[model samples]
Target chain A: EAAVTQSPRNKVAVTGGKVTLSCNQTNNHNNMYWYRQDTGHGLRLIHYSYGAGSTEKGDIPDGYKASRPSQENFSLILELATPSQTSVYFCASGDAGRSSYEQYFGPGTRLTVL
Target chain B: AQSVTQPDARVTVSEGASLQLRCKYSYSGTPYLFWYVQYPRQGLQLLLKYYSGDPVVQGVNGFEAEFIKSNSSFHLRKASVHWSDSAVYFCAVSVGSTGNYKYVFGAGTRLKVIA
Candidate 1:
């Protein structure tokens, strides 16, 4: 089974604080993504990376930035966190191997910004 | 722009009962459809997907879905649901080629299974 692991499963931050969430995948997938989940709002993509040193903005990328330092690691950064940024964040990895359609997600990080 | 609509916000069913979660998509060309389940405090897991050929596809945990191109719908169904099946279900669609990996998700449907 493909394994995607995320760090700091639960987080609490004050407004204007800098917060970072990390993810690692052993599946050797070429694509990684960040998303936030909210009640009644569903999951919305924030950022995605094609590979190392490549990051692309998603539908809801305004207050978030993503980094892929290596093929196995991806990080979501909140430079200046705010109350609105409080939500459950998920990291996912997908391999375009004949099919870019399916994405495997890691356990989410619940962020609370006061 | 591509979009998905999961009209039901919540669904309640007794254990061992049949299940159906509605999902509709709006996109030009052949669409790539998917269903994912998110358990409490867990990540979303792919339940099933439909690309072409088969109108009905089976997934894990006795779950399945049927694609009706005429109505632009891909509804998820389960013959006998278990209590562990309670979770939030998301319907998603990717426009154009799947290689592009662009996806649009619905608001989600929360399922509550009564034992």
Candidate 2:
């Protein structure tokens, strides 16, 4: 029951528009993440991947940019969007050989930069 | 420099009542705790996790959590609560290792279940 799927969901850019947020995982889990849930700053890791092409840089990675061309897909790039990059954006999938690494989420994308 | 503290941002129980949501962590070693549950737009799930011997772990629905390494704390429990259990409650901490782990979240705890 670990299926992470996200795309579009809700968006409305305009600052410099180039937004793109999409993630897909069918349990193949090899680690993949990109978070951004403000409101007191709860979730913040901005990019992560450890399979297919690799890409890592968490702890609020600047304006954001990431892509893992394989291993079930993972992408989060906002080339030039602004308005503080809006908010709510999450996509996770984990399987560090499992020992309770626990992670498998995707049901968010609500961005809104204007 | 790992951190996670959920010093009660908001909590209000009622229906059947009985719940505790609080977490703290500074990380020095032996840490890998988690307890998530976000249900508004949805995105976080997994209501229990603690690496190492049992310190009282049990999750999903009934929920439960307790791992106090000399009070670094990892609180989250429930005895009855219902209102769909309200929402928002996160507390995570997973320092680096094996595939480069690093998850430190905590600024959540917004449950409101009244009758």
Residue-wise C-alpha lDDT for candidate 1, range B1-115, written one tens digit per residue: 6889999999999999999999999998778899999988889999999988979999999999999999999999999999999999999987544445767899999999999
User: Could you give the C-alpha RMSD of every candidate to the true structure, in order shown?
Assistant: 1.4, 13.8
Q: For residues A32-90, could you state the per-residue lDDT of candidate 1 as single tens digits?
A: 88989998889899999888999999998998888999999999999999999989999
- lDDT against true structure, model 1: 0.90
Model 1 residue pairs with clashes? none
Taking the tens digit of each residue's C-alpha lDDT, what string does model 2 give over A3-61? Answer: 99999899999998899899999888788889999998789899999787999999889
Best by DockQ: 1
TM-score of chain A of 2: 0.33
The native-contact fractions of the candidates, in order shown, are: 0.83, 0.68
Model number 1 iRMSD? 1.4
Score candidate 2 by lDDT. Answer: 0.89
Poorest 10 consecutive residues by lDDT, candidate 2 chain A: A95-104
Candidate 1 residue spans exceeding 4 A from truth: A98-100, B96-98
The positional error of residue B59 in candidate 2, measured at the CA in angstroms, is 13
